[model samples]
Target: MVGRAEFVSRFGGVFEHSPFIAERAFDAGDVREPMTAGTVHAALTKHFRAASQDERLGVLRAHPDLAGKLAIAGGLTEDSRKEQAGAGLDRLSPNEHARFTELNAAYVEKNGFPFIIAVKGLTKDDILRSFETRINHNVQDEFATATEQVEKIALLRLTAILPES
Candidate 1:
């Protein structure tokens, strides 16, 4: 069994700065051994599912828009910076960057939150295309889509951080 601090350290950033998810997981039961990527991901997703609509919105909002201001300001987390870079966000041409900026604004204006996508293994072109398509969804559907994207991000992060068995 692990202590609360250690549990948080391991699982906190799985949800992109959302330590409360880890805390909730630890409180939901004793922190058992052999917490694999799947187990930790399920723990985190349980809390995400239990969150109120407003809380889910906050979690979705915690994410930086792809190639958006946070990346420009260097305010994204180390993991986020690397993930974004991996998605070709860090090497954007001027025109692509402008297109992203425009899409970000339009998406947020329509959805009331940043567009959430798990950028790992995704090309910028894929993300841009998804943005165009996902923006067409109604607000309620968009909310569901954003929440699902957050869960996907958490699973990928968990897979990276969980100790190899």
Candidate 2:
């Protein structure tokens, strides 16, 4: 176990290392401690501090199209990926998968980036509906949405990183 000074230094390092995460870490001041192992807030604050928005979104943007891509490395936590996979979209019926493919393609074509959403606690239906709903957002609107999603994701991650005592 880390001593308080070491923990504080390391914990602060989590913020200094990544701007996106640092922003979130600052918001989670109540839980920012090395002792907060296993809590979602700490994990997110640490992870976000170390990752870029693109990297974080890449993790949140799980899809067959990105399955074989290496660019998404360092994008998301292992737990988040597992949660998203279990969300059942990967098991969508053939027709549904095809529709999703089309939508994914169109979204990428228009935005120059993949559609991103945090799938941690959302159902498959909600995930699909979110795709449809968010597709209509303009670039500026979508950017805001993405940031908001990131914050929400950070909160969820924090909960996991630091379970309530």
Candidate 3:
């Protein structure tokens, strides 16, 4: 296995802009396990739980909105671009794109942070439904829910990177 520095570099941005998640996982993982995505995901979960509210919010904010402005501007990170495309977000019909933009605006206006979801295997319809549902939650509950989605997204990204061992 590679040393800690390489491990961190490879996995750091797995959680959007949060390199600290990978660093903490590297520090916490079993010396016996092969540092597979699952193990790092477990370790990262622990660190995420221990993080302050602001730190959690920061990582959530780091994620781009699904098929939102960044995608239009072609500014998303390659990983995000691909993940969104996996669910047909990239080729959205014009009406669907407009709906997403309207919902995204409403969600962010309500929650200060962008809506967060692990849009791996879901359709644009599923994402829109989730956005409609989550937008109604009170701030505290939505904050907790958004962080949970961040953890799930991190695990999914890690899984994408590591081959099964």
Candidate 4:
């Protein structure tokens, strides 16, 4: 197995761009000491400290677009992509695909960013449903939601990096 240091070194960049996430991930420790849920939670709590409303909103802005080409390539993990594609836009009935495309475009336009949700366990239909629901949120509500989603993503990453106990 890869040591903790190498694991952190390799994937730390994933969190570093976001101060809240980076600090949380870093606090989990080096290669020798694997991340724990406590560490992740502590980091998140610290980052959230005294954050202004706008600063909190900025966290949402920091997320990479979900369907944007660069986001697909840089932000998403290989497994996530496979899961998303397996749901297969291509397999969607022509009308469904067209609706998805339209929804995606409108969502991006409204949010000024790509729709993001932790898709680890969710099916394509679930994701589409989440998109529809979240797309209706006002900027402030969505900002809060995005941060919560980021926390979920961080937790997922933490599990991936830590050794199985």
Candidate 5:
């Protein structure tokens, strides 16, 4: 078994600034030899899902607004930067940026947290459409949706760093 420190160091940011999830997973003792992306993702997400609503909301809120000021300022995490760039979020036209800004504000105002999506393999247009549609969901539903997206993002991050198994 990997030591707790090394496991946490490798997987700490899988949940977007939520290192406690990794710590909790390690403490849960589910990590075994020959760890794979799938197994790591499952263990991390198990603790994430089991966290309190407030804790989960913190995870959601830790995510930067899609294509917002952070992206403009190059303040996003490396994983987020690459994922957004992959979706063409880094090359937004002025109008597209404006629309994204508006949508981001509206979504955050309606829901307590910023909109979170996996972003991998999705186009900017696809992301915008999802943002527009999902913004209309009730707060409870939106919260649940954001939670799921966080899990998806974590899984993708894990897969990038570990074998699939």
Candidate 6:
């Protein structure tokens, strides 16, 4: 089994900027050997779910807005950059970019957090459609949806870095 330092170093950003989830999981002795993506994701999700609402919201807030200024400025994390580029977000036309920007603003304004999607196999249009649909959800429902999306993103990231169970 990996020690806490190595474990945290490897998986700290699984929950976006929240290394505390990994630290809390390791400190709780939740992580075990045979750390496949499924096992590690379970451990991390446990701690993430256990975190206070503010902490969870912080995790959500830590995520970069889709096709927003940070992405345009090239300020996303490596995983995020690759994921967005894979979705063709990096190559959006100006009109598509504007739509994304407008939708991102409205989503954040209503939900108090950015739209969160797994975006692994999704196209730009797929994302835009999702954004438009999800924006109409009430804040409470949207928060739950965003939280679930964050977990999905974390799992996808883990799958790339670790073996599946």
Q: Which model scores highest in lDDT? A: 6
**Alpha-carbon local distance difference test for all models:** 0.87, 0.54, 0.83, 0.57, 0.93, 0.95
Question: Taking the tens digit of each residue's C-alpha lDDT, what string does model 1 give over 35-141?
Answer: 88887777779988997888888888888888989999999988889999999999999999999999999999988899889898999999989988998999999
For model 3, the run of ten residues with the poorest summed lDDT: 28-37
Residue-level lDDT of model 5, residues 66-125, one tens digit each, is 999999999999999999999999999999999999999999998978999999999999
Put down candidate 4 lDDT per residue, 17-64, tens digits, no spaces. 445444444455422334454554445545554456665556555655
What tens-digit string does per-residue lDDT give for candidate 2 at 1-165?
444444344433222123344344445453433545445344554555366767655543532232212223434335445555667654567676667778778877766566666676677788778889988989777766765665565555445544454
Model 2: weakest 10-residue lDDT segment is 63-72
Q: What TM-score would you give candidate 3 relative to the actual structure?
A: 0.91
Model 6 Cα lDDT, one tens digit per residue, 32-151: 998999999999999999999999999999999998899989999999999999999999999999999999998998888999999999999999999989999999998899999999
- Pairs in steric clash, model 3: none
Candidate 3 runs further than 4 Å off = 28-32, 163-165
**TM-score of each model, in listed order:** 0.95, 0.58, 0.91, 0.64, 0.98, 0.99
RMSD in angstroms between candidate 1 and the native structure over all alpha carbons:
1.3
Ordering by lDDT: 6, 5, 1, 3, 4, 2
| Model 4 TM | 0.64
lDDT of model 1 at position 12: 83
Task: Put down candidate 3 lDDT per residue, 1-165, tens digits, no spaces.
Answer: 667798778878888988897787677653225767787777778887788888888888898988999999999988899989998899999999988888888888888888888899898889889988888899888888988888888888878887545
lDDT of 5 at 43: 89
* Clashing residue pair totals per candidate (backbone < 3 A): 0, 16, 0, 2, 0, 0
Q: Work out how many backbone clashes candidate 5 has.
A: 0
Worst 10 residues of 4 by lDDT: 24-33
